[model samples]
Target: MTSELPPLPDTPPPAPTEPPAVSAHVPPAPAARRLSPLAAGLIGLATGAAIVGGTWAITANSGPDAPATFTLKGSFALTDSVVPDGNGGCGGTRGYDDILEGAGVTVYGASGDVIATGGLGNSTYDGDTYDCTFKVAVPDVPKGERFYKVEVSHRGTVQLSGKEAENGDFGASLG
Candidate 1:
């Protein structure tokens, strides 16, 4: 038996059309990669350090007395350099040593006035000295307030880890 089929519709079948239009132009840059925990921590630490350092430089100048005190602690490293002409107390005409005995940091108020001061004792590791840490009790930063500054000082010798960094005015936060 022959099967009868319906005639074709008036409209022709759809054509094999090309894919939808897509621009060849480069897309926006991909989002930044995520950081590992360790990397993220290190970055955070570095950023915090930079901010504090900047604040320290900006706040080294004299300012109105701060009613609140700030206890600031931070780490510092010195680059090798020639010893100053002074011949005593970590300073000698000869090349200086990287390790230092007199290393300290002073906190300043927003107005660039001295607030609190603390010393960084020498940190020795396998007969090598380093500036590792410091703790100071500054009685000038008014509590509850944040923005501030500081003056970091480290008296070290040449041929050693120390730099004649200028007294800077660093802008910072009270954290």
Candidate 2:
């Protein structure tokens, strides 16, 4: 046998849909403020000037608190053959050849420590003398009286010593 079912109840109808509306009291979005062409150009010019000035100062002074350098100036001659100065060098009464070139010169401090070294430069060829001057920058040398020795050597076998090697700002002669 079949059973009977209950009937459904009545219901209300639904409303139609639409896009949401914005409020009238809300303000509109504002636009971004911009500088004029002249103002922008001036600002860029100032920035460039500042950067250039800073770089120039850093380069010109070699940085603040850089060590003070002292220069040791000298000259010498070279011989074609080796001579004896009793110290495996040509620092005595030995005669040199036409000119001395490519000689390694080293300057030492008061404590017998090497201060600076370089090759001879500014060669001037006179009548019977071949001369060259060397300049070396010695750093961290304390102020006051100090002794300096300049040795001009070649091939580690023959060399020459300055005349006033351990004294004032004197010019040393090659032996």
Q: Which candidate is the best by lDDT?
A: 2
Name the TM-score of candidate 1.
Answer: 0.30
Model 1 CA lDDT for position 139: 35
Write candidate 1's Cα lDDT for 1-175 as tens digits: 7698888899988999998998889979989998999999999999999999999889888566746333443334332332322332222122334334454455544455554565544432221332122223333344432344444453421111111111122222111
- Candidate 1 lDDT at 21 equals 95
- List runs of model 1 lying over 4 Å from the truth: 1-70, 81-99, 125-142, 154-175
What would the C-alpha RMSD of candidate 1 be, to one decimal place? 24.9
Candidate 2 weakest lDDT stretch, 10 residues: 154-163
TM-score of every candidate relative to the true structure: 0.30, 0.36
Assess candidate 2 and give its lDDT.
0.49
How does model 1 fare in lDDT? 0.43
